[model samples]
Target chain A: MLVLKNIGVTFDGGTSIGSTILNGINLRVCGGEFVIIIGGNGAGKTTLFNVISGLLRPTTGQVMLDGKDMAKIPAHERSQYVARVVQNTMAGTMCNLTIFENLAFAFTRGKRRKLLPYSTSARRKIFAEKLESLGIGLEKRMNATVASLSGGQRQAIGLLMSVLAPSKILLLDEITAALDPKISDSVMALANKIIVAEGRTTLMITHNMAHATAYGDRMLLLANSHFQREFSGPEKEALTPSELAKVFGEV
Target chain B: MNTLEIVSGVEIGLIYGIAAIGICLTFRLIDFPDMTCDGSFVLGAAISGILIKSGCNPWLALCAATLGGALAGLATGIIHSFFKISNLLSGILTAFMLYSINLRVMGGVPNIPLIGAATIFSGASAIAVLTCTCLTVVAIFTYLLATDFGLALRSVGQSKGVSTNYGVNIRLANAVALMLSNALIGLSGAIFNQHQCFADISQGVGTLVIGLAAVMIGEKLFPCWSYLLIVPACVVGSIVYRIFIGFALHSEILGLKTQDLNLITGLLIIIAMAAPKFRRRSC
Candidate 1:
């Protein structure tokens, strides 16, 4: 389980040399539950993600993963328990590296990077099979560099990479923002499939209302430096894109 | 030019090729502008010279020089990552500090003569010795860049965000890369000092430029995308560059003298860098 209690972030800039970006946020995500957070510009959605990923330390309160306080842990160490996929397609994957190489890197995530060759026959077979599941024929092009792939293809590969390693929590930070609507739908579907198959606790933040309502077991609206509303079960199932949009504008 | 001049050029090229490979690692692979190359080169020479003069085994002295270079790289990495200094400035600062360190290593002397002291080249032919050493270093690095750690290293250069998310310690990777890069440069410096029978503190001047020229020339000439080919290309480019220099020095017809080497090298790098742009514009 991943839990955040009384988390707050204040940027060191502005009239008073500080401005609050996030405040008094409390969240608890159970194992295998998918949570979606929706927010407009400057609503501190990314900051909240950063705080959970240990990229930013909260001004107050605690981030607990499996009942262990992780506020002091660095991002790289926190990654052992949490896997994140960012919005920038190029940010989540190494473009210059080959598809096989990129997958190989994710395959050994959180593990010691030994001096041994990363791609053995056995590992290569596994990577190819994983790519094959994407239905994009990336398996046949394992030797091709990621830079040569399209944006949607790269993001798909990025999503695959995050789930390749075993982790308790997966944070998808607007990962489909750069892709077209159709591509984003497919990527989201793949995400849902992976989350169900692996039963991982996931937190996905998005600006797309449709995506926000379509995939999550629980949905949270973040505005004015805190969660404005939380919907789940039948309440979340009854949420429509227009109603969510109206609520977003009202806040 | 006589056959002897060509032979000497090849020897110098092979020795300096190791430094060029190091340059490729920092500048090309890791995207770090490592100015530490200049001082580390001299550091290598000084360490090897001091040890060899003190009657230490020449091979052991070479190893020490390599480690000394790695330390210089580590210093830069620490300043950059730990202290939050910019990469370029961190390298410049380390290079500045290494000047005094190199002088101190040579016991306050700016130059040391290795003449009459048994060196690695005591009996081995310069060509045979350098070729063997260069091949060995190249093979080892090729194997290194093909490993899991190599992937992590390259990923850190490509995207720090993804590297962190994947559990890579960016600072540690940068440090390791710089250490490996400077170690190779140090090896070349030690070889150069032994080959020339002297270690001059000023010999490190323009070392970075020379290495850059070799790396650029190799990539421009061979134009391969794979690191596997790019690694060897560094050596080939160094050899080719040295041959050109050899020709320029002997070309009285062109009114070129040995002192004009640096001037021509700077111009050559500019032309090489701009040529691709010109080609693309024309196309």
Candidate 2:
């Protein structure tokens, strides 16, 4: 579960050449609830994620992780409870390192990293098995540099990496936007499968109306600096893909 | 080259090889454009030379120099991260400040001579000492890079946004990488001053260039070395670079001399850089 109370972010103290991006916003995500969000440009969707993840401090609000105030915690510290997947393929993995090394990094996330071996032969076997399940043939190429992988493969790994270690929350931000249509479907399918199987509270942002209406137990439309509409339970399941697309409207 | 020339080349090369490994940590591993190695190198030599002159054990002086250099790197990191200074400017400012601090550390002297003192290489053969020291440094460096912390640092360099998403503190990783890099350079400075039995303030001016050249040479020689073997490649590159330099200086038919050292080094780096591009084109 997660709670954000009256979050606001303003640049330059909002006095001289200043602007406010996120203002008076509140959101609550229940346990095991898959929440889908749709927002236009500068709707403060990413900023909301940033505030929750402790990367950006709100000007007049606090973030609560399971009712615990996270205003003082740094981004790195917040990662203990929250896992994030980004849209950028390059940003999700280290190109210079092997797939095993990246998984090792994910496994040790939010934990103290001692000067001990991060991956052994046994660990490699487990990692290989996990990669094999991705159906990308990444298992045999455990030692191969991640740079050599395609964008879709990288995002699949990124998604898996976000779930590698135990956590309560998962954030997916336009993760499949860059992939080809065929690849995007499978990656999103895999992501959905993992989120539901783990029964984790998940928040995902996407521009696809079909996905918003087709997946998740709830939907939130963020517009004009705050959450404008919310649907859940029966109302959420009743919404159609065409109705979701109409919500975006003509400029 | 004669035995003395070859011996001197290996000894100096080993010392610089250690420094090159340090440079590789920032430039290659973390992809950080760190320019603080110049000041740290001289600071290492100056601090170690001062301590050895005051009857301290050579090894202890070297350790102190390493810590001191780390502190210097920390300052650069603070300026860059907290003050939001550009990374290049941060290193340049710290390096400028360290120039004066190095002189002050040596009692406002421009140089210190450590002749007839108990140094790390006082009784050991030049070849043996250099070989042992290079191996030890490479071992420690490789081990560090293979750890989770090292992976985090590399990730930070590779992509800050991704590292953030993964919960890595970008600034902390940068600071730690810079500290480790400069510390190794500091130790190299210690060995250098001991081998030459002197420390001069101006000696650090061209140090970064040499370290960069060594990294380039190493990568060129072994393009496919993984992160583990890459450490040894850097060390080997430093020695091979030094040997190349020594040979170029000693050549008679080509009419090369010591004064042409800088020209040759610059040309070698250019050639190494261009070789990869040419290979790709040919392929």
Candidate 3:
């Protein structure tokens, strides 16, 4: 379970030079629930995610993961329970490393890295199987540097790396915003499949109404640093893109 | 150049290769233009030379020199990571501070002649020592790069965001890399002092240029190779660079002198940098 209670984030140290980015934002996500959050520009959606993931500490609030207070945790330390994938194609992965190298790194996420063998045959086999399961034939090019891959492929690898972590919650920040429409839909499908299969709590931010309405078990409309509306179960399942577009219009 | 001159070039080149590997670790892998190598190199020589002169074991002197270099690297890492200073400026600051420390290490003397002193390879043939040491160091470095710790170091270099997101201790990785790199460089300085039987505070001048030249030459020579192969490739590149200088020094045709060493190195670097562009144009 992930919970955000009365979260508020203000830029510029909230002192002489400051602007409130998030205000009294409260949210809770249970295991096996995929929450899709949509907002217009300057909606504080990203800041909310950052606060939840411990990248930015909120001025007033508490972040709880599995009923434990996570407000004091640092970003890297919080990664033990929370994994995040950012929007930039280049942000979530290392370009100088090979696919296998990247996977090997992800395999040790939130864990102490030792002088142990990085390319053990068993670990290699497991990574290979994971890649093969993607059905993208990436297993054949494990040795190729991430710099040589396409944007879609890079994003795929980013998602793959995030899921492989021993995380209780997955936070995605516009994961497909950089890809083409076709690739974006495919990635969405892959993410949905993985989230359901893993039964992990997920929070995904998207700008596209179709994506917001098409996937996830719940939908949230955020505006002016607050949750304006929420739909779940039958309402979320019956939500339409036109209804989401109307919400955006009102915002 | 005669065979003896060529052999001398190879010997010195291999020694420089070790230092160049250290430079490569930061400049290429971690994207840090670490100027700490300049002062740390001389620091190593000063410490090693003084230790040997005090009748300490030669092996112990070398180890102490390596540790001194690691300390220099750690200082730079601390300033860069903790103070939020730019990486280049932090290295420069550390290098500047090390000069005073280095002079003190050598008893306030700018030069220390280690003649008749026990050295790490005092009884061995110079060429044999160079060959054996180069092979072992290169092998160990290559193996290190193939480990999990190495991957984390490289990851931080590639993307700090990704590294942090995945729980990689960025500061720790940076410090570890700089320590290892400077340790190798200090080893080079120690070995060079032993081989030449002298240590001078000014010996580290233009050290960065030489290492940069070697790394560029190595990358030019072998653009694609495994991690292990790439390391030895750097060593070979360093040797070839020294050979070019040797040929220029012994020139019977160009009327070149030893004093023109810097000019020739600069020219070679220019050529190396432009080679790929010229190749693409021709194609």
Let me know the DockQ for model 3: 0.79
Candidate lDDT values, in order: 0.91, 0.86, 0.87
Number of the top-ranking candidate, with lDDT as the measure = 1
Model 2's CAPRI class is: medium
Question: What's each prediction's TM-score?
Answer: 0.97, 0.95, 0.96
Q: Lowest summed-lDDT stretch of 10 residues in model 3 chain A?
A: A231-240
Native contacts recovered, each model: 0.82, 0.71, 0.78
Best model per DockQ:
1
* Lowest lDDT block of 10, candidate 3 chain B: B225-234
User: Between prediction 1 and prediction 3, which has the larger DockQ?
Assistant: 1
Off by over 4 Å in 2: A11-19, B278-283
lDDT of 3 by residue, B1-283 (tens): 8899899999999999999999989987777889999998998899888998889998788899899999999999999999999999998999899889989999999989988888877788888989999999998888888888777877877888998889877787888889988998898898888888899999888888898899988987888845656678778889999998898888789999988999999998898889879999998
User: Chain A vs. true chain A, TM-score per candidate?
Assistant: 0.97, 0.95, 0.96
As a whole number from 0 to 100, the lDDT of residue B87 in candidate 3 is 90
Task: Sort every candidate by lDDT, greatest first.
Answer: 1, 3, 2
Better of 2 and 3 by DockQ: 3
lDDT by residue (A1-251, candidate 1, tens digit) is 99999998888834577899999999999988999998899999999989989898888889999999997789999998999888999888999888988999998898999998887999888988888888888899999999999999999999999989998899999988999999988888888888888798999999888888778898999999999999985787788989989988999
Worst 10 residues of 1 chain B by lDDT: B221-230
lDDT of 2 by residue, A130-240 (tens): 888788788888888889999999999899889888776899998888998899989988889888888979999988777777788888888888888888757767878
| Most TM-score-accurate candidate | 1
**What DockQ values do the models have?**
0.82, 0.69, 0.79
